[model samples]
Target: MRKRKWSSALLAASAIIAAAGCGSDDPGTVSGSEVYDTCTTSIADNVPAFYKTYFRCVTITMSGDTVVIKTDGLPPHNTYYYGSGHDKYVAFDFSKGSDYHPNPNTLKQQNVTIQIPAAPKARGLTINAAAVDAKVNSSSNEYGLGPRGVALDGVSLFNPLAAPGDDIEDEKYTFDPYNAHPTNNGAYHYHTTSKGPLELLKKLGKTTNTTPGQAEIEVYGMMCDGTLLLGCKELDGSAPAAGLDSQNGHVHDIKDKAGTVHFTGRYHTHVCTSIGSHKYTPEIQYYDTCK
Candidate 1:
């Protein structure tokens, strides 16, 4: 699949003003103001199957000229903003699906409402009565595949509009789509880190400790034989049968002939933090190319 670029118009309209630069100590600068006009963007394509339950029939409500996001009838989803120029990134915790359980049958047909402060300096946004289920089928990967591995065949990342002076690395970062982890049923889920939704909170200038609401590190590439390579910590004990452990900044050669990837790590549950010295035991699944 071709890479997609976030619309520049949308980015410009959604950009937030930097308050820290003005020596403002107020954390509520962005509370309860709708600056940007409310617009809806569909996640049906961008969101992987693992996150489908949370995204299906969802509508994103953006405050005019501000970064606040509201949703209707969707699972608790995090919103992150990576600032441009000299602006620092910030994340907001909207709601958690795990804590609130709604009837799946009713939720599927319900309409949810999310409200954020208007733009420029909106704050204290609240999401209310959004009908949704926190039931993330632990049995399946976020994707719909059953125990069989989910194929990465159609996935690719590239810039749609590359100018001569554009930084290649930046373009890659913007276009690259991370691979999803497979569940015991071969279904795939979009790990929080891959989608850039949640913002990562840093402690004392350290990149390792991520505070909830910040973006999780992205994992890319898979060995033909099923070894998963990621940019985060290696929570899984030994490397898979093939491929390099990119998580630790070390590259390994592929040893398996089938090119099947395996995620032997534990799922980090922190909303804005990394897995700190924790061991991970992944649920196993296999994927093949979609014909």
Candidate 2:
């Protein structure tokens, strides 16, 4: 698929339309380095079936041994961060109570391109010596406060780390119901469970359950280092059988909707907090190489 270029008139019109809380039923097709309005692009049919179902309004293609996914780094769902008058904007869920202070930052378009290993391998007992040891050198590969991974919904996933001189536990209070918030740079991201992605999967008939349960298997997303992120259950709606490593990771063949092996003997991590599991996306890098 060729990327379209945005003309000056389209940019100006999109800005006006967006501020007026309206967008085209058609994917806004204006082309540019950044996507400022609606996402009109489509994932290539040759892309993995898993991504095709989840990564809507984004572009996915293979580059050598990696799958390059390009997105605007914005949420397609409604949120207070979308700002008032924007079509995707909605009031904050005050059900979390009066303490839910919306962060100062708002959502914006970002030119983000995520490249993940096309075929990932399991780092058995002998890990990549050059890579930061997820078990021993935990501090070295800690996830920075940026795009650690891309969600199926095209938003970014941040590490669980708080800003300088702040506690992650304290930061939890600021997260919306989707367990996501924008950074100071206007980059919206999720550090934990995302109700939005789960709902998207359910809408696609990937799973039936919405709330946390043993019957709901959830594929959260993939990390930059080729680490697959899953929820409390496996693809078959079964709980994890083996103990996860320090990074909440383990290795096995994960299958797709048709029971075909999607990832053979690959490494992935679980970020299910619903079952009292404290795991989140690894702050530390474990793969030998990541782009």
Candidate 3:
């Protein structure tokens, strides 16, 4: 989470994307509360263990039945978008594949505010968790453009669709080694599998590897629809169940490797290309409205 800024002046001059700002952590910020040494912020106290323990680079709090997550939309990883003068900048690397190349846009600070259900239910199901219809939430709505979700490492999550005519399968060439790229507005995000969040989990002792299929466990992040995005294996280091849908998604009790159950019969999906060619994030939303 360490990014070296060239100078204080440059920090002051850096322009932020419009219409973004959030926080008011669990207990909210109180001046300068040490969060990251690379940068410091006065995050709130009493924050939920989910946000406090698993996430960074963002501020969060519980407001009624919702988890109000707010982030500046910048990832805590090296990439070409950080700009040459910035420390997070690593020269454009197309080494992973010949198709890799830099995009025309540069990274910019994003103003993003995302609100999701604290306890989610499938769209066609009643709040009581009983199915009433066959209609499921569509990716065209919940997964629409702009901050669809947030990665554990404080990055945004976008869909696989590219800019109108472009193909996301090809646009990935523009992504950094972390498997992420910025949009026209400069917000960096992930649409496919990436080593970024896995690396974070590694540092936290949550897993032993960062490689997708090989990683002991791979939990990308949550979508706005309350869909848990997972990779090759389930959070408990077990194979996904037998009833996954076309998108490799299914519902069951969610547990960490330690066997601590988090959610019951929750909807989640695996998107690891190495596991089976499920290369893109789920395009369909299984849950109801995403705040």
Using TM-score, give the best candidate's number.
Answer: 3
- Model 1 whole-model lDDT (C-alpha atoms): 0.23
* Rank by TM-score (best first): 3, 2, 1
Query: Can you list the residue pairs that collide in candidate 2?
Result: 4-31, 5-31, 6-31, 141-284, 142-283, 143-283
TM-score of each: 0.21, 0.77, 0.79
By lDDT, who's the top model here? 3
Which RMSD values do the candidates have, in order?
21.3, 9.3, 9.6
Model 3, residue 113: C-alpha shift (Å)? 1.3
How does each model score on lDDT? Answer: 0.23, 0.66, 0.69
Model 2 weakest lDDT span, ten residues long: 25-34
Supply the global lDDT for candidate 2. Answer: 0.66
lDDT of 2 by residue, 74-153 (tens): 78678888889998888887798787778888888888887888775433432232332323324545655678788877
Clashes of 3: 3
In candidate 2, how many Å is residue 236 off? 2.0
Give the per-residue lDDT digits (tens) of candidate 1, residues 1-291.
222223445333323322233323222122222121121234222322222211122333233422121233221222122222312212322243232221112111122232222111211222111211112233232222212111111111111112245432232332113212222222222322343221111111112333222323323222222324343432222222322211212223322112322222222121112432211112211222211
- Candidate 2 wrongly placed segments (more than 4 Å): 1-38, 121-138, 212-215, 274-276
